[model samples]
Target: MRIGLYPGTFDPVTLGHLDIIHRATVLVDRLVIGVAINRDKGPLFSLEERVTMIETECARISEETACEIVVHPFENLLIDCARDVGAGMIIRGLRAVADFEYEFQMVGMNRRLDASIETVFLMAEAQHQAIASKLVKEIARLGGNVAKFVTPEVRKALQARFGADC
Candidate 1:
């Protein structure tokens, strides 16, 4: 089966992420959402929480698309994680030119590590292009409405985390 891996530190899975996940189902029989355990980023949510959020959000996508979706948490290299999940492609969501610059370098490095695995970039929808988890968290922390960026469930999680009625 064609398996694809999409790796990210989904501190709180945003609508932007769901957009990518929904689109990615068309490209692979199985889509593995790799929740990275990057301690350096000091994510707002724990790995377990991130995985749970992804699983919950993706369940509908999986059912609608008939593509098996799995949430796999990884603390190792992304390329290695791809191999672990038997992914022949690594899916990435691009928001802007700034994101491309960083992703370009990552693609080069990942190619050097394993030329067999290819990386595919999916541009975010215009509406979701501006939504980022970091910015979403900041907006929530400051008591701004984040209903536009995240699902109602995730919005509640952020509200609980920040103890604000955002």
Candidate 2:
């Protein structure tokens, strides 16, 4: 099977992620949403909560796309997660030149870990290129409505994680 790894910290799994997930479905036989646990960054939601958010959002996509959302609380390197999951390709969402620059280096590093693993970049829908999980979480924490930035499932997850008090 052509398995593609779409890895990210996905603090809240924003619409841009969903869009990438949507686009990825068309290119791979199976898309594994790998939620990397970034040891350096403190997240708004716990790993369990993030997993639930990913599961719920993956399910929200129409049934035609056989996308599997796998919550990998990876304490190790990102490429290790891909190798563990048997994903042949690493899929990334490219928003701007800055993202390309950063991801370019990452792709090179990942290639070094597994020479056969290919990195494919997908452009986010124009409307969602600016939406990111961190930005969504920050906006939501500040009492800003992020309904446009994420799916309904993510909205509920974020609300529950942040709560009305925040």
Candidate 3:
């Protein structure tokens, strides 16, 4: 079976992430959403909370597609995680030119680590191109409405985390 890995901080899986996940499932037999436990990033949500939020949001996708969607937390190198999960491909979401430059470099390094693992880039929908998890959390923390950026579950979680109605 063709398995793919999509790794990200996913602090609170944004609509952009959902869009990518939906489209990515069509390309691989199984798509594993690897939630990175990067303490350096200072994520708004804990790894467990991020995994829960992604699981709750991706339930429908997992049911509808032949592709299985798995949300797993990993802390080591992304290439190592992909290899560990038997992923033959890595799925990445590209928002703009800025994102490409960074992803491009990472892809090269990942290729060096495992030449067999391919990387696929999916462009975010125009509407979601501007919505990033960090910005969404910032807006919500400052008491702004972020219902459009993230799923309802994530929004509720954000509200509770920030102690403000978003």
Candidate 4:
């Protein structure tokens, strides 16, 4: 069976990221959504909260579908996480040239570490190319209504974290 790994620091999964998840569902038997524990950036949502948001969102992705979602809060490194799960492919979403530059370097490193694994990049939808977890936090922090940009669970989690007034 072909298993695909979609790893990211989904502080709160955005619609854009969800799009990739949906696309990934069609390409593999199972899709592992690895939430990287980004200690350097300091995530706004705790690992538990991120996992909850992902679990709540991923659960609603239609059980009848061919693929299933596995939410994992991964720290340390991505290649290790992928190796642990036996994923031969790393699925990524490309929003722009900048994203490509970074993902490309990481892809090369992953290939060097394990030549058996490879990275796949899918272009983000035109409308959601600019949406990101950082962008979601900035808009929410500034009191912007981001209901349309993310799932309801994510919005609720953000409201809980930043307060309803925010």
Candidate 5:
């Protein structure tokens, strides 16, 4: 079976992420959503919360696409995480040229680590291209509507975190 790893902090899975996840199903029989435990980033959601969010959001995608989706939390290197999940490809979502610059360096470093595992970049849909978890959180924290960037459930979660009015 072709397995792919899509790694991210996923502090709060955004619509852009869902877009990539949904599209990635077509390329792999199993898509592993690697929720990175990056303490340095100080994510808004805990590891368990992030995993639950991803699992909940991806359940429908998996059912619709007939592709198995798994959420795995890891604090190790992304390349190591890919190997652990038996992923032959690492899927990444690109939003803009700025994202490409960083991803390009990552791909080079990852290739040096394991040339066998390839990286695939999927550009975000135009509508979702501007949606980012960080910006979404900021907007929520500042009492702005985030319904456009996240699902109803995630929006609810953010509201709970920032208060009902926010």
Candidate 6:
């Protein structure tokens, strides 16, 4: 079976992230959404909250995708996590040229770490190419509407975190 790993710091799941997850399902027998517990980045949501948000959002599209979706939390080296989950490929979303450069370097390192694991880069749909978690949080923090960028549950969480005025 072609199991693929898509790892990221999903502080609060966004529509863009879901878009990638949905598209990734078609390329693998099983898609694992690995939410990274990176304390260094100081995420807006807790690890459990991030995991829960992904699980909730993924569940909404579970039936529509061709592959099984698994939401998991991991820390440290992503290559190790990929190995642990028996992922033969690592899926990445490239939004623009900036993303390509960073992802390209990481892909090379990942390849060096595990020669057996391959990396697959998927370009984000044009509509979602500009939507990022940091920008979403900033908009919410500044009392801007982010309902269009994130799911209802995530929008509510952001509202609750940044107050009702957001």
Off by over 4 Å in 2: 67-69
Taken over the whole model, the C-alpha lDDT of each candidate is: 0.96, 0.81, 0.93, 0.84, 0.95, 0.90
Worst ten-residue run, lDDT, model 6?
A: 58-67
- What's the TM-score of each model vs. the native? 0.99, 0.91, 0.98, 0.94, 0.99, 0.97
lDDT score, candidate 1, position 146 = 97
**Residue-by-residue lDDT tens digits, candidate 6, 55-148:** 8888867777757899878987999999999999999998899998898899889888899999998888999999999999999999999988
- Model 3: ten consecutive residues of lowest lDDT: 58-67
The window of 10 residues in a row where model 4 has the poorest summed lDDT is 59-68
Measured with C-alpha atoms, the lDDT of residue 142 in candidate 4 is 83
lDDT value, candidate 3, whole model: 0.93
Residue 135 shift from truth in candidate 3, angstroms:
0.1
Models, CA RMSD each = 0.5, 1.9, 0.8, 1.3, 0.7, 0.9
lDDT of 1: 0.96
Clashes of each: 0, 0, 0, 0, 0, 0
Error of 6 at 45 (Å): 0.4
Provide the global lDDT of candidate 4 against the true structure.
0.84
Measured by TM-score, how close is model 3 to the native structure? 0.98
Better of 3 and 4 by lDDT: 3
Ranking by lDDT: 1, 5, 3, 6, 4, 2
Candidate 3 lDDT, 58-144, residue by residue in tens:
888888876799888899999999999999999999998999999999999999999999999999999999989989988998999
User: Candidate 5: lDDT of 108?
Assistant: 99
Which is the winner by TM-score between candidate 1 and candidate 4? Answer: 1
Q: Which portions of model 3 show Cα errors greater than 4 Å?
A: none
Please, what are the lDDT tens digits per residue for candidate 5 over residues 1-166?
9999999999899999999999999999999999999999999998899999999999999999999999999999899999999999999999999999999999999999999999999999999999999999999999999999999999999999999544
